[model samples]
Target: MRVAAFLCEALTRGTTHAEPLAVEGNRLDFVDTLRQLQPDLVINLCESLAADSRGEILIPGLLDLLGLPYTGSSALSLGLALHKPKAKELLRARGISTPAFAVVQRPEDVKAVDLPYPLIVKPAHEDASMGVDFDSVVHTPAELARAAIAVLSTFHQPALVEQFIQGREIYVPLLGNAPRRALPLTEIHFGQAFENRPNIVSYKAKWETESPECRDSTSALCRLEDTALEERLIQTAVGAFSALDCQDYGRVDLRVSAEGVPYVIDINPNCDLHPGAGFAKAAAAAGIDYPALANRLVEIALERTHGNPSHRTKGPGTARRVDPPNRNVLAGRGPVRHRAGGPRAHAE
Candidate 1:
């Protein structure tokens, strides 16, 4: 099988995100390579091109145009997931317990917010914890205005001000299509250094391994004694995943309140898949190793395209010939705020 592991340059070597896709495959660092050496399947790890996350859907959009099957969510799903506010709106509409949020399209728009304070302000259309820090959690209107203004000026997008849910942070990873199941859940335990800081996962905690924020925030497989509560959390996660129309695999991040209610914080359809990431670790807990997980993604894509995954499991899978075409005009980010009675964005 000629499988191409599509990834960005920073994820090429010696990185946590690079190790999961070490399965037998060709390493494609550029879209041109994808055009020249067409493969049977693609394990898309390239979150973005040209260092802009807005370009995350460009490659997948191209593959879709060329009728090439790839792993994870589609271009439309990626674009929808990239916008935090819009995603939350859909979740709320589906009766999913998400924090109340207000979108600040401009700095002055902050005054229109009616949600309770101690809101977490972040860039409207970004992932990987971009533009999120301790200061993002504001308790006063003045602080909210300042944070929203900073996010607007920095990310050139609206600021999503969501109610800050303080509780146990949990992440649930889901896989497959017809019968999607939740992997072992992970709980983020903030250490002593986090005593004075908000418990939210910031960009520094995610991208900077050496930083105090990253070092102090730890993740462990959750252990629950209440079976009913555990069941509730699983149902919530699955409901949110289904609501988003996430395909192949995705992760749902939530915070368990003091009353044991789970609130959906974020739904990442194209989340990190490195061997050390929470998703892979959860898969490992279920006895599916990284190599097998990677291969399973390929098989899922093949199954969705051909209706049978059994044949693809054998080595050297047959490739459907596809002619290269002109690049797609990438789909940009959707509207920052959902208009009243306007169409909603769903999983593709």
Candidate 2:
């Protein structure tokens, strides 16, 4: 609700109108509505379709079919980022640093996992830490099997088991294209409540606000003690963003090892833009307030209409989908923002 309202406010900042257009199901209805409405632009905030995370990729694909210019990453990028193993592979292919990870389909599959014991287990296809919990971080073989099985059964997806980097967890928000600027870094702060707890941003830590995990963990602007590590963090984050083919705006999450090496933990395209989101906080740190950040995203998408991937993807007929003089209110799909970890299930 806040995501759509804020985006609408931002779109209307310059006389352009925007409105929330939630799709409660029925793809045909959604399609017919967009065609009839023929919106000049769409500020897409949806990370899923019909409550299914995998369906998020189809949202952009649907918008493209309607020939409407929408803000954020493309269908291909969203798909890659939503599937953990695929995104990690792309990062590795680009020579980017990501924690060693394996996909486990069953409890027995944990045996084939050659990674270290102090690893994190999570739903391979879930976002917003939907299936992640304090138990997700395991230190023993038994713990690993339990965690993997929990994710596999609960989320109905394979489990992603990976080495858990022990260090600072940082979030780098990227805005714009060609230059894809990285905003000031933000890190998750653990308070006294986390004293005896494992220092990890679990699902409860990110979403269950009333829970101790969430209360103990807070997101704040962070400056690395070592300036050099800061730069590497930014560079590696940008590399991950580019490797995932994210556009307009996104967030790259990382856990810097004690050795100061930054490992790409997750790449989120079309990241949450709520005023209180991590991406928004980083943007605010860089002097791009929520409203201006929203404005910039719309402008970035518009700027790409000339021979860019967006334009080419729109194809010839979709050219008419550009900002027409009769452009009505910019429609949007709301309630897709991740209010917890703050992503498109953002890694905390």
Candidate 3:
């Protein structure tokens, strides 16, 4: 089947994270060319548009209106995943463990946090460690207020002040939808440089490739000596993924405490799919190469939308899965601007 890879041009500029030349390559007119070619399916690699993550769902939404099939989650799922607080509320309601979090829209709102100290503050709707740093984890109310203010003033979004989970960071990548299977657990290894820093994936550690933090913060397939604990982590991750209503392939990030309890931190449906990314790395550990993984994503989308491809191969993408909007409180609307202590609200 003819396939088109959709990517954002914003990543190439103002960030050393991903090589624009390599990611964009010769597909400069990728979107336009995609419209011209009208491929059988789309492999969405575009995390955002013009550096704004809110635009991540726009392309997929367009594809839906165009009556096209695409890999990964739907437009609604992407929106829900981008906003951290909304996703957390969904997980907590599912009986899955997520750190208690309060969204601070103003600097003074930080004082309203009823959760414990040593909270990690982050931009409410960003991914890939954006607006996160070592200083984001605060030990006192003053530091939390400063961090939340910084996030509010800089990113111009509400700050998500969550209880900092001091434990091992585990990443779980799930494939398929109905009978989704979790890949081998991957752990972020904070190297020697992080001995003095908090064990969290900060912005510098994730984006600044040449920085020591980036060099030291790494991911490796975790080896679980206890099979029961391993199964529990996988089950928790799967539960979190299902709670968010993610489709196709997605990754769930969790933090395991000293007591061996796992807390879901983030659910990324349109996570980085680079061959070197955590999702692909976990897939590789499970014997699924990049090509196979890509094909499998397409296969899953096809199976869900068109039923068995063998029987419905003749159609012009007539059979499509109509994803009904989730009616839950955390349903798709926009970035939820979480209140300090009251009802959860969102911002664009």
The candidate maximizing TM-score is 2
Select the stronger candidate by TM-score from 1 and 2: 2
Collision count of model 3: 3
The 10-residue segment of model 2 with minimum total lDDT is: 339-348
* lDDT, candidate 3, 1-348, per-residue tens: 001221222121231111111113223344554556454555565556544678777767867876666777888888888888898888888899999999998877877898987799999988877788899999998898889999999999999999999999988888887678998888888888888779887766776666677778777889889898898898998898887778988888889999999999888886666565677778888999876676577668778767755235444555644323321101011222221221100001
Screening candidate 2 with a backbone cut-off below 3 angstroms (N, C-alpha, C), the clashing residue pairs are: 127-345, 128-345
Report how far off residue 62 is in candidate 3 (Å). Answer: 0.8
lDDT of 1 by residue, 2-69 (tens): 11222322223331222222111122344454456455556666566555677677767877876667
Q: What are the lDDT figures for the candidates, one per model?
A: 0.71, 0.78, 0.70
Top-down lDDT ranking? 2, 1, 3
In candidate 2 the C-alpha lDDT for residue 191 amounts to: 84
Q: Which ranges in model 1 have alpha carbons more than 4 Å from their true place?
A: 1-33, 309-348
Better of 1 and 2 by lDDT: 2
Better of 2 and 3 by TM-score: 2
- Reference-based TM-score of each model: 0.81, 0.90, 0.80
Q: Indicate whether candidate 1 or candidate 3 has the larger lDDT.
A: 1
Deviation in Å, model 1, residue 265 alpha carbon:
0.8
